[model samples]
Target: MSLVAEHVSVSIDRADLLADVSFTAAPGRVHSLIGPNGAGKSTLLGVLAGDRAPDAGRVLLRGRRLDEWPLRELARERAVLTQEHGVTFAFRSREIVEMGRHPWARTPAEDDDEREIARAMAVTDVAHLADRPVAHLSGGEKARVALARVLAQRAPVLLLDEPTAALDLRHQEDVLRLARAQAADGDAVVVVLHDLNLAAAYSDEITLLQRGRVAAHGSPAEVLTAERIEDVYGQAVEVIEHPRSGVPLVLPVR
Candidate 1:
C-alpha cells in the first residue's frame, strides 16, 4: 500500500503546525521523517495516521482519500505506534498484543489471531513477558510491547512515531532492522526518527522538515548533507562514510 500526504497543513490556536507538506510511503520502502523538535514531525504523522484532521490538503491511502475509508477498514490498512505507550489498566503483555487482531474479528483472518499474536511477541522479544502486567514493565519493555501490538495488526502502512525512543542501543538497531525487514516484505513503512544516522542507514527516502515545511526530501545522501543538517538543526556536524555500509555517518562537531 502507498500512503500519501498532499499539501497537508495543520493548525492549532492560530499557529501552523504543518504547512504544505507532501509525503509518500510506498511499498517496499522505508521513508523517514526527521527534524528538530517542534518541526511538526509528530503532528504530520498524526494526520497521516488519520488520528487528526488536517486544516488543509488531504491524505490518501492506496489512491483513495483517507476520509473515505471506514474506521475499521482504515485500522486494517495502517498501524500506528505513537510516542505514548501508557496503558491505563494493567493489561497483560500478550493481551495487549491481541488487541491488534481486533479489527479482523469474525472474519476469516481471525483464525490467524493466535499465530499472529505469538509471532509479533516473539519478533519483539517480548514473548517471555507475555503474562506480565504491562504497567509493571519498564519504559523500554512497554515500548516493545506496544510495538508488538502494532506488528500484530499486520497493516501494510506503518506509522511509527519514535518507536526507539525508550530503547537501548542494541534494541534501537533491532527495531529499525525489523522495520527494514517489513519494507522488504512489501509493506510501506513510514517512521519518525530523531537519530539522523539511523535514518540515513535505514530510510530509502528522507524528508527533512523545519518549522512545519519541507527543507529537503530525497535519498539519504541527497538530503542529509553536512550543510543541510547544520542549517536545519542549528548545529555544526561532519558527515563521514560508514566502513561497512557506506551510508553517511553524522557526527556532531563539538
Candidate 2:
C-alpha cells in the first residue's frame, strides 16, 4: 500500500505551506520525514493521510486518487498519529484505544479487537495504565496511549508526526522499533523525526524536506551526508557510521 503525492501543494489564506511536494513511500518500508520546525512536515503528513485536501496536484494511493476512496475505506488503509491532544472526557485507557476500531466497526467491541488493543498497549508499554483515566496520565504516558490507539487501527499506512518527542531515550527506541516492525509487516510507515540518528537507524528510506519542499530523498547513506545535513538543516552535522550497527549516525557540531 504505497502512497504517492504528485506535485501536491497546500495553500491556506494565500500562503503556500507546502509547494510542489512529491514522494512515494514504498510498501513495507519505514520512510523518515525529517525537517526543521515549520518546514511543513505535519502538513504534508496530513495531506498524505487525506485529512487535508491539497490546493493543487493530487495524492494517490496505489494508483487511485485519494478522493475516489471513501473516508471510512481510507481510514482502514492508513492511520495518523499527530501530537497528543487533550482528552476532554474522562475515558479509561482501554476506552480511548477502542476508538481506533470505530472505522470498521458498528459494535462497541470484539474478542480479536480486545486482543489487538492489549497487544498494542503492551508494545507501547502502556498496559499498566489500561484501567487508569486518560486525563490523569503524564505527557509521555499519554503519548504511548495515543500511539496504541493508532496501532489498534491496524492500517497498512502509518503516519507518525514527531512520535518520540515526548518520550525518554529507552521509550524512544521502543517506539521506533515498533514502527520498524510495522513496516516489516508490510505497511508503509512515514515518521516525522527530529532526531536524525534515530531516523537513520530505523528507516529504510529518508525524505529530507526544507522550506516546504524535498531537499533530498533516498537511503540514509545516500541522503544523510554532512554537507546535505548542513544544506537542509542550516547547521554543521557529522554523519558517521555507528560502530555497533553500521548505520549512519548524525552528530550535530555545536
Candidate 3:
C-alpha cells in the first residue's frame, strides 16, 4: 500500500503547523521525516496516519481518500506509534501488546493473535517483561513494549513518531534496523526522526521539513547536504561519508 499526502495543511489558533506539504510513502521503502523542533514532522505524520485531519488538501491510501476508509478497515491497513507511550491503567506488557489484535477480532486474522504478539514482543526484546506492569517499566523498556504493540498490529503501513527518543544507542539501532527489515518485507514505513545520521542511514527516501513546509524531499544524499542542513536547522554542520556504510554522516560544528 502507498500513502500519499497532497497539498496537506494543518492550522490551529491561526498558526500553520503544516503548509502545502506533499509526500508519499511507498511500500518496500523506509521514508524518514526530519526537521528541527516545531518544524511539523509529528504533525505531518499525524496527518498521514489519518489521526489528524488536514485543514486543507487530503490524504490518500491506496489511491482512496483517507477519510473515506472505515475506522476498523483503516486500522487494519496502517499501524501508528505516536510520540507518547503513556498507558493510563496498569496493564501488563503482554496485555498491552494484545491490544493491537483488537482490529482483527471476529476475522480470520484473529487466529494469529497469539503468534503475532509473541513475535512482536520477542523482536522488540520485551518478552522477558511480558508479565510486568507497563507502568513499572523503564523508559526504554516501555518504548520497546509500545513498539511491539505496533508491530503486532500486522499492518502494511507503519507510521512511527520519534521512535528512538527514549532508547539507548543499541536499542536505537535495533529499532531502525527493525524498520529496515519491515520495509525489506515489503511494508511501507514512514518514521519521524530527529537523528539526521540515523535517518540517512536507514531511510530509502527523506523529507526535510522546515517551518511547516517541505524544505527538501528526495534520497538522503540529495536532501541531507551540509548546506541544506545548516540552512534548515540554522546550524553549521559537516557532512561526510560513513566509513563503513557509505551513508551521510552529519556532524555539528562547535
Compare the candidates by lDDT and give the number of the best one. Answer: 3
Residues 115-209 of candidate 1: C-alpha lDDT, one tens digit per residue: 99999999899999999999999999999999999999999999999999999999899999999999999999999999999999999999999
List all candidate RMSDs to the true structure: 0.6, 1.7, 0.6
| lDDT over C-alpha atoms for residue 135 of model 2 | 93
Task: Assess candidate 3 and give its TM-score to the true structure.
Answer: 0.99
Each model's total of backbone clashes: 0, 0, 0
- The sequence of per-residue lDDT tens digits that candidate 2 reaches over residues 33-135 is 9988888899999999888999999999978999999988888889899985579999999888888887868645444687888889899999999999999
> Model 2 clash pairs?
none
Q: TM-scores for all candidates?
A: 0.99, 0.95, 0.99
lDDT of 2: 0.90
Candidate 3 — worst ten consecutive residues by lDDT sum?
A: 81-90
lDDT tens digits, residue span 105-164, model 3: 999999999999999999999999999999999999999999999999999999999999
